[model samples]
Target chain A: MRLGKRRATPLPELNMTPMIDVVFQLLIFFMLVPHMTRVNKELLELPKLSGTEDQQESAITINITRDGQIIVTNEPRTVAGVVEMVSEEIRRLGGDRSRVKVLVRADHRGTSRMVNQVVSALAKLGVHQIRVGVEVPSR
Target chain B: MRLTSRGVQRDRKIELAMTSMIDMTFLLLIFFMTTGGFMTIERDLDSAIKERPSGRAASSDLEPAIVEITRVGSGYVYRVGSRELTTARELTDLLRKFPNKIDGAYVRVSDGAPFEMAAAAIQSCKDARFLSVAYVPID
Candidate 1:
């Protein structure tokens, strides 16, 4: 007598429910993670501009570069030279330094620290009313 | 008691490995420890020009010595009384004198000039120890 033949069965379909659940969980986990950042708050402070035309004849304008170069009245000057020249100018202006106003125009790329060096130096001379210049594009 | 060879049998059990779990925990711990703090840069008041209040007008008596900085090709052209300066030192020399001896020193900066040039000018004012600085924005 011949042995009975063994029966073959078809493969069962895969269940994708667990895989979808895992993917959704991972998405939620990543969304909850906080981003890291360092912000500068002091740079946001804006100075007041009196813009009085009457003082126009009394203000001194100073321009700055990213690398800390200075240009004044269409002339180029070194850091020390600028100080010396300003001192002499103050002395010559009837020896009244208080009447001298400084207007500083610096690039956006330059750090506040770089700008402060100029302010501190001016402060030592007992002059006040520092005006900073900003460029607003014409509408 | 001694076991008979025919009656003795070996059994093996499966368990999860803990090395991966330890490594993951260490990674997470290091990540949190190294990146939890943020730095805030303080605003230096001396570097900023104050914002003028609304509805304020310019002084009519002022005669501004307008020093216009025009964008020339890739660089900038500094002009004072129709004069141009080629060196950084020259700019400082002119700024040093400023409105002290002159009636009005108008500082008009171009939008295209390198920031360093502008900063140097401001530094010159600081060196001269002038506190009253005014900045004019160009179109």
Candidate 2:
């Protein structure tokens, strides 16, 4: 009779502790991811190319908008300012220009002159590993 | 009086109503998941910009193919040597059919030319099996 009475009572409360812990962890993860991915990326329509290469992690990202405005890390920078920033980055990398990779994200409708200015600046710094950001068409 | 005191002690056991907390957590989780997943993935195209040696004469025997991109009225024009092409397709075909491709190719983009055309020219050179494609910005 005691066993039957125990069974009649509601099921033992689920150990909500572990479930809550996992849920909170997932919430924190999701909260952090968007900021991390969006730090260097600016909203621009990149060129669509068929045989584009994969994206490698770059130390610096330069963005060029349709009006030929240059931005780095969300801050509008001139060609000279960009060079200064790159020089600082190189110093942080132990003065190794070879190890520093730069990614240039230019709007498709933007003038190539702007892209060229940034590329020329990087080349002058002797940083040869440059990547132009593009979007590959989804299959 | 003893039964009442026992009931008060049971109430003090702190039975947290977890259902509301769990519901809120799930709601937050779903919101973050949906927002985070909406970000678009971007890729990169590898490019190299090397500093040109000052006052170096071009060797006629080993000159790379140069594709000049100029902005027209509304569209763009691609010029390879003396040949003028209107579309990237034509340029690609012409580059592919070149008899001597020992040297890679140079994509010279003029001012006001859209980045899309320049990228397409580079992609065309690559598709034509050029060993390297150099981007040169011309004024």
Residue-pair clashes per prediction, in order, are 51, 0
What are the clashing pairs of model 2? none
* TM-score, candidate number 2: 0.74
Per-residue lDDT for B12-82 in model 2, tens only? Answer: 44366678677767877787688665555677667566545222223342245778786557878987765
Q: What's the true lDDT of residue B14 in model 1?
A: 32
True contacts kept of each: 0.06, 0.62
TM-score for chain B in model 1 = 0.44
Best model per DockQ: 2
Predicted structure 2: clash tally: 0
Q: Residue A77 deviation, candidate 1, in Å?
A: 2.4
Model 1 TM-score on a 0 to 1 scale: 0.31
Chain A of model 1 scored by TM-score = 0.52
Please give the range of 10 consecutive residues that has the lowest summed lDDT in model 1 chain A.
A36-45
